[model samples]
Each structure stands twice: as C-alpha cells, then as structure tokens.
Target: MATGTQPPASGTDPRRAGHGVRGATRAAIAPRHLRTDRWWLAPAGTAAGLLAFVVYSTWRAFSNSDYYAAPYVSPFYSPCLAENCVPMRHGPNWELFGGWWGLSPALLILVFPLGFRLTCYYYRKAYYRGFWASPPACAVAEPHTSYTGETRFPLVLQNLHRYFFYAAVLVGVVLTYDTVLTFRDEQYAWGHMGVGTLLFLVNIGLIWAYTLSCHSCRHIIGGRLRHFSKHPVRYRLWGWVGRLNQRHMQLAWASLISVAACDFYVYLLATGAFADPRLF
Candidate 1:
C-alpha cells in the first residue's frame, strides 16, 4: 500500500461541502493573509468606535443625573419608568418597577434597545470580526482553532434578535413621544419649539430608520409569502424595507451617534452648560 496523501472520500465534492464540515482544508499559506493593503485598519477602526460608544454609554447610563432637562429628555432615559423620574410635561407617567427600584431609570429601559442593537445581524458580524477577531477580515486567519458557529450557549441567543426588534419598535414609539414633548416650552405651552426640538426630531428619525430597517422587520413583513402579486401592499412595503436594509449598517451607526448626541445635548441643558436656544 502506498503511504501518501489521499483524495476526498468517495462521492464527496469540495465545492458542494458546507462550511465547518469535518476534514475541510484550505491552501497552506505561510502568512495569515496574502493581501497586504491595510486590512487591519477596518477591524481596528470598528473596534475603537464600538468600544468608545460602550464606554460612553455605560457612563451615561450610570450617571442618572443630567438625563432630563426642561422640555427635553435623554433618549437613553425615555419612558422614565422610575417614580423618582424628572417629569416631562405632557409625557405619560407610566412608572413601573416601583420606588423600590432605586437605580437609574435609564437602566430600566436601556436593556430593550441595547438588546436589539446587540443582537443586530450587522452588529454580530461587526463585533465577531472586530472584537473576537474571528477571521478579523476577509481571507484573514482567525486565532480560534475550532468554530462552533452560533450553535453554542451564548451565540445561540442571537436567535432572539427578532423578538428584540419588536421591543426596539416600541422604544422608537416612546422616543417619538419624547421628541413630541420637546416641542413644549418651560411654561408647558404646546406651541413652543427650541433647538432641542429639532435635535430630538433628527434623533427620532434616525432611531426609526434604524429600527425599521432591521433584517427581522423585512422578514416579518415579506418572508414566507408564496406570491408577491397576491399581496401588493405588502410587496410595496417590503420593497421599501429592502432598500433601507441595504443601508442597515449606516443607519445603525447614525442612530447610535444621534441618540448619544441627543442625550448629551440634554445633559448640557440639565447641567446648565448652556441654555436651549428658542427657535420659535
């Protein structure tokens, strides 16, 4: 018998074999990736951007103070679920979880939006490559020797993204409500508008864009339909969503930055850093 390399097992075709199939092999390249055109920059930049947001959000979430300014509330603290919340004029006092919950009111509601973004399909790909260095970039070798995919414990939770999308939609509605409240002046009159109002409007717009552009939203609207012609309204709506879906990554980052900026603007107002300029 000849002791030599063996071909793939009988009837097996390399092209048809799915990823992570046992005994799969690749070209033996000495370098991690042959392409040298600044591949590391993308993953590095992504990691830095995500990390900065995480740190800033963590700080703001825990700060508790400066989340509410007259006629404006931070996006991070909408719905104001704690009894100790600074009231927003014309805003619903839908406090729950009781006075016993003494933590930041932001903490009460941040989970839903955070979970939605955390489980976002684009985000999963972003962090997996950026933070986990799973291949880091295209054609790059990952340090992980074995790939279980999302079949394991924590990664398996990504399947709950669809449920999180529902929660995100509700959060968007609440943010819309909050933005509406910003239209009122300190006197609680309805006809007033400030710079904050415009900021709130832009923030809410981005939030809705990001929320509605979700892959889950697209699937829910259009998936499982056998015939597009049978549902013309749905087909049109699905087409709109499909266009937005192509820009999902951009919407995600835009919403993130806008939310933080809206919150920070309110923080400035709350801290008396500057007066909210009346634009009426």
Candidate 2:
C-alpha cells in the first residue's frame, strides 16, 4: 500500500480550506447584516443640515446690508473693520487696499472661523461621511476604489487645524469685545441689557464651549507627558479638557446653531423686522 498523503476532496483545496488567501485577485466580500434598518438617514440628515447652514451663511455674509443694530452686530459681521462696512461707533477702522475693497465685512473675518471648522477633526469625519459618502455608514461600501487619506494635496491642509485654532481664539477675543460693547446703548452709556445682549452672551458661551472642547485643545493641554503623576497641574487640566472633549460633537453643533441664530437675530433688529426687548 502507498503511504503518501491522500489527495483532498474533488472541490476542496486543502490550503484554502480555513484561511483567507493572501494576495487574492478577488474583491472583498461584505457580510450580510441581520438588521434591515435605514442606515442612510443619519448621513442624509447631516448633509441636509450642513447644506442649509452653508447656503444661509453664504447669503448673509455676502448681503453686507443690515448687519448691525444699536447694541447688536450680527456675529457674521462682528468687528466690522472693513471700510465698506456700515459706519459704526466702535470696532477697528483698519481697511486694506486703500478702502477700495468693496466686500462685506464678514468676508474679512469669516475665513478664520470657517477654516477652524473646516479643519476640525470631528467636522472632517462628519462631512466625509455626509457629503463625500466615503463609506457613508458602517457596513456600506465606499464609492471610491481606494482612499488617499489626508496625507494628499488638498487634505494635507488639515494639518493647519492647530494654527486655525489659534486664529479662532483671537477671533473669539474680538467677538467677546463686541459682546461686551453690546452692554452700552447707542449713546455708549452703560447699564443697558436687552434680548440682544442675552443672545450675544449665549452665542459667545457656546462658541467657547465648542472651541475649548476640541481634540487639539485637549492634546495641547496634556500630550507627550511621560508620567501623569509628575505633572499634576497638566493632568488636572487634561482631565477637564477630556470631560469637555467627550461632548465636543454636541458643543460643535450647538455652537453652529447658536451663532447662526444670533446673527439672524441681529439681522432682524438691523432690518427693522423685529425689536430687541429690554431685559433690564
């Protein structure tokens, strides 16, 4: 009798029986899911929300008119430093290019906030799934053959997120100054508070919440530490930031809505469509 190992069954390849083949030519096969839920809904809603905000903000930013009301300036046009900006008693008077730039004041400052959000890690994930449909949801196949990731040309700009965060902080300072200025009436006297003032306060609060809750801010607070015990202060600071970071996504969306609402409120006041009720 021959003692050689027996041949495998007719249809079975012994080497391929249990393990996945290396360097296989065949495309990957996705597994079937038990749940038949509406997975597209979340991405669809995200896309719609983002689109609506973009449209509204773009229109308001370009409008240039009715961006200010006494004791209230639209967050879109705060720190109205452009020469083309409607005359304001406060805010910087510096205008570039000999004041010939006939652009909305929002144009000068919106870039900072926009760049910060654009390069935000949370926002990148949100829009990547929402707008690009890059594997829109789990279990769904991506439209692209492969992903180049953020290491490539345009996406490489994401590395500027930390720098944008610094600019955002400066912009926040300017906005805070604008909010403080809101306390004074048109005559510039103090002791005035109105619904507009409340709006500005809430808007700034939400902005700070969003900005402080950033992952980059968390890393800056305490990254590359060899030992937590050695840096007690940084450890505590990191703890606080981590708590905020846990809710960063919520803060981000809330801030977005609050800012838009605040801008719209100022617009209404400026347009005489609505009045700011006195709280005090």
Candidate 3:
C-alpha cells in the first residue's frame, strides 16, 4: 500500500543502498593484516638446538656398557629408598639398547626448554619477547600493510587449549605415578638406573603441572575473572588456581629445571655413577 511514496522507478534496486553502506564502512576502518619481520626465529632456533642436545644426550643414556657396578656403597642400607640395591642387569649388554631407548623421553626434553617459552602471556604481548620463542636474529618489525586477507583457516580450534589442559594434567598424574613406581622398581634391585627412572618420573609431574596450570590454560578455561574477586566462595576456590595461573612463567622454568633434573637422575644411573634401591 503506497501512501504517496514512490516505488523504484527503474534499474536501481533497494539492495544497492545496503551494499553502498557496507562499502563506506569498510573504507572508514583501517585494514588489520599487517606484515612483521620474523624475529622470533632466533630464540626458537636456539631452543631447537638445545633440544637436539637433549635428544643426543638421552641416546647416551641407553648405552648398556655405561651401566657398571657402583664404585662405592653405603654400609647403612635404606629399604624405603631401595638404596644399596643391585643392578637390574649387568653391563656390556647391547641387547638392552632397545629398552634403553627409554631415551624418547628425551624428545620431551625440548618441551621443557623450548615449548615453555612459547606459552608465555608476556611473550605473547611483546614482539621482542615473542621472538625468543621462534629463532635467532629475528627482529621487532612493523606490522605488514600488504593486507592480502584471509585465504583460509579460521581460528576456532584455538579453544582446544582448554582440552589440552586436561591432557597436561593427566600427564602430570602419570608422571607422579612414575615417580611412585621408581621407588617400587628400585626396591628389589636398587641401582643408578632405578633412581634415574624415578627422577624422570618426578620431573614429568613438575612439567605437566606447570603446563596444565599455565596462564594460557586459564584464558582457555577460566573464561574471565574480572569480577570474581567480589564473590567470596569463588574467590576462595578459584583464587587458589589463579595463583598458579598468575605465576605461569615461573612454573614453566621450574618444569624445565625439573625435567633436566629427571634426565640427569636417570642418566647418572644408566652410567652406574649412583645406586638405586630395590623396592620390589
């Protein structure tokens, strides 16, 4: 019902008005797809190199000949520790290399040294800090203005980090169990290998706990904590978790140190430099 209002007279369609409005809007806002120099490569590279060292050193941990009788023993044996226990097997046994490849645990060594740096919220905030997670010689450069635009890969999956928290926590539990097991295994035949294996297990718990309790995980799972301080019950419970979340970087480094500690514990054992216990 047209009450003196004129309908479109010819070629111009009403939809054209909506398109024009959108076009004008796009012209007003600056485009965001800027290019930056890849300075993150340096730290990333160094981290990778160190990771390689961990892998190689881990391989050495498997050499059976490296396992020999401990040169000294304490006359006072501790059953709980499995201290003064005998070796699981005598040395010069290459057949044990496959089993010794317990070395793949070394592949994880890089996660402690390298991956930890990548997950930092502070690094995420600054280009200089962020580059450390990448490679060497990378620089802080301006955002690129080329604005080619998104070809694909929408970032919806980033939410999966919340799920990763579950995985990391589970791994922590596994590591804790491994530590508990180390004590059991060494009880029957305490040696360097037993103690070393236990140490690795303990470090696993440290790293996984650090990773699972990271700030990134908080963002992924905690949703937002802006007003929770007003809620007492929530503050009491969630506040505890947030404490770890706030100290994310510390946890990362702590985990890194613990992982190395774990590796050393076993490496020395594999070489017979120390004695483990016989828990069994």
Tell me the alpha-carbon RMSD of every candidate: 5.2, 4.0, 12.7
Model 2, span 39-94: residue lDDT tens: 98989998898899999999999998988788777888766767787877775664
Candidate 1 CA-lDDT value: 0.88
Off by over 4 Å in 2: 1-35, 91-97
What clash count does candidate 2 reach?
Answer: 0
lDDT of 1 by residue, 1-280 (tens): 3544555568867564444556657644577678869999999999999999999999999887898788888889888888877666655567776765468888999999999999999999889999999879998889999999999999999999999998998999888988888878887788999999998899899999889899999999999899999999999999999999999999999999999999999999999999999988
Give candidate 3's error at residue 180 in angstroms.
Answer: 2.0
Q: Least accurate stretch of 10 residues (summed lDDT) in model 2?
A: 26-35
| Deviating ranges (above 4 Å) for candidate 3 | 1-159, 189-205, 216-233, 276-280
In the predicted model 2, the residue pairs found to clash are: none
Task: Please give me the total number of clashing residue pairs in predicted model 3.
Answer: 34
Q: Model 3 over residues 201-228: C-alpha lDDT tens digits?
A: 5566567557756665555444565776
